[model samples]
Target: MEALNLLESFVRSAEAGSFSAAARRLGITPAAVSKNVARLESQLGVRLFQRSTRQVTLTDSGEQFFQQVSGPFSTLRDAFASASQDAGKPAGVLKVSLALAFGREYLVPLLGEFLARYPAIVPDWHFENRPVDLIQDGFDAAIGGGIELTEGVVARELVNTHIIVTASPAYMKGRPVPAHPDDLAVLDGIVRRSGPTGRLRAYTLRNQAGDEAQVAQCTRMVFDDPEAMAHAAMLGYGVALLPTTHAAKWLESGALMRLLPGWHADNGPVSVYYPSKKLLPPKTRVFIDFVVDAFRDREFAARFGAP
Candidate 1:
């Protein structure tokens, strides 16, 4: 068992590139990981890593050894985990990355019920507006749109989010409502700037007839966050393009009105992502099923569709 522990520590540190990152994935302290690797090196009578202040690089011998052991080690670990879960309740820290506004508005509300059902599982959730590397970052799962489906990862789509044009009633009070997509060009546009790229987000609204119109809104204001853009539109800053998930509440409350209802941009599918493991950990499996079921039960796919 101790030998297996040493191998686990070495393999994880080698894959993660540093003791600190390996510690995060293993849910242990960096000192413990470093100590285990040192012990392994002592037993094998070989230096496995070239350590520096910033990172650790595998030695030639270590790289060869890693290639030999990693595949089998992972399979053995999965088998053990599967056996343990079959004999016990699903338990462990479930680390997830979530889109900030979408998580707060929709997913976070389901936490209480999730926790009540799986009391043994602890939730470690990070909310941000960015794509994450699920395997490298050691997350159990991630939820949002526009995330790359990297190798060894799979996505279960939740909804096809539609980006619709919207604005406050006050903003359109004296101005004429847009009768067509081209009319949005003359309106004061509260636009979104891409967080990953500095360029402004371009919108091309399409209707059921397969007709498309590129939105050339006069940029009156800009923001990187969708929630901020929605708030700005609610304050009557200008006409804004927003995903239905972001605008749904205000639209229901009459704070914002849909403009040129026939036209909308397809924002693509919002999905829950996880590693393509043959034997998924029980904690991750349950969390994925829970979220997928909730979305289906609530009919979020229908709710977040084009108007």
Candidate 2:
């Protein structure tokens, strides 16, 4: 009945991408949701969503309006809940998306412990390499590198996901040890393809001293997953640039040797991303904190890279 109610319906519908979903969330009918949105659109003298049989998408102006209003509206809701002390127990499905290798090697081990701490929470997690649209997909959180920060999402740093150049010891037995980053251009390179963009990743190396060198990687073999690429390097395929966190285990077992140890590619921080600060559910909030605390200290440091 109120203008704010109409706007709330509009925001929920836009983010959910359908009137029926918004109605389900609001405990109303799809017709009611449509009417509220239509009334709001008439008052504003602008179309907010382009309705289709498949999905509802925002117009350009509606996108801008959502950006401006969503954060504050979420904050208002949070404030009301806090005032009423109704931000109660965190229960229900806590859906998460994570990188395949990182989830397998790191997050999976901690799941039992996390569930023990929050028995009310149900773990609904997906492991994949590509970036996930947290808001659109209705996930509580997603973790890994190369997370593009969108308006309704935020990233908390989990670890520095820097990369190192490495190769199998057998591959280096007869070859001249690279004295500098440039010498690696002569060695065979096993490269990785970008999961998000599907382009071959280039070798870009940097050191603590801030010197930078980039090589247009010539691929002897190509793989999409980092763990797979690391396996290729360990089998004496060629020198490969890999995330130290991912490569640390093989390097420790002497399956691979860090080459030009001083040089590394500063890719980016592995971050745990969530919906937004204002509307952060307790399930999402605690999980984010749990992950950061788990990895921030020494999990990957002594063998992996500088913490």
TM-score list, all predictions = 0.95, 0.75
Global CA lDDT of candidate 2, please?
0.82
Candidate with top TM-score is 1
Cα displacement (angstroms), candidate 2, residue 261, comes to 1.4
Ten consecutive residues with minimal summed lDDT in candidate 2?
Answer: 78-87
User: For model 1, how does the per-residue alpha-carbon lDDT over 1-307 read when each residue is reduced to its tens digit?
Assistant: 6987899999989988999999988889999999999999999999999999888999999999899998788778767765676347788789999999999999999999999999988999999989999988889899999889888899999989999999999999999989899999899999999988899999889988889999999999889988999999999999999999999889989999999997999899999999888888889899999999999999998888885
Model 2 agreement with the true structure over 62-160: per-residue lDDT tens digits: 999999998777777555443443347665668899999988888899999889988878898899878888876667899988878998788888777
How does each model score on lDDT? Answer: 0.91, 0.82
Give me candidate 2's TM-score against the actual structure: 0.75
Cα distance off (Å), candidate 1, residue 57: 0.4
Give one clash count per candidate, in the order shown.
Answer: 0, 0
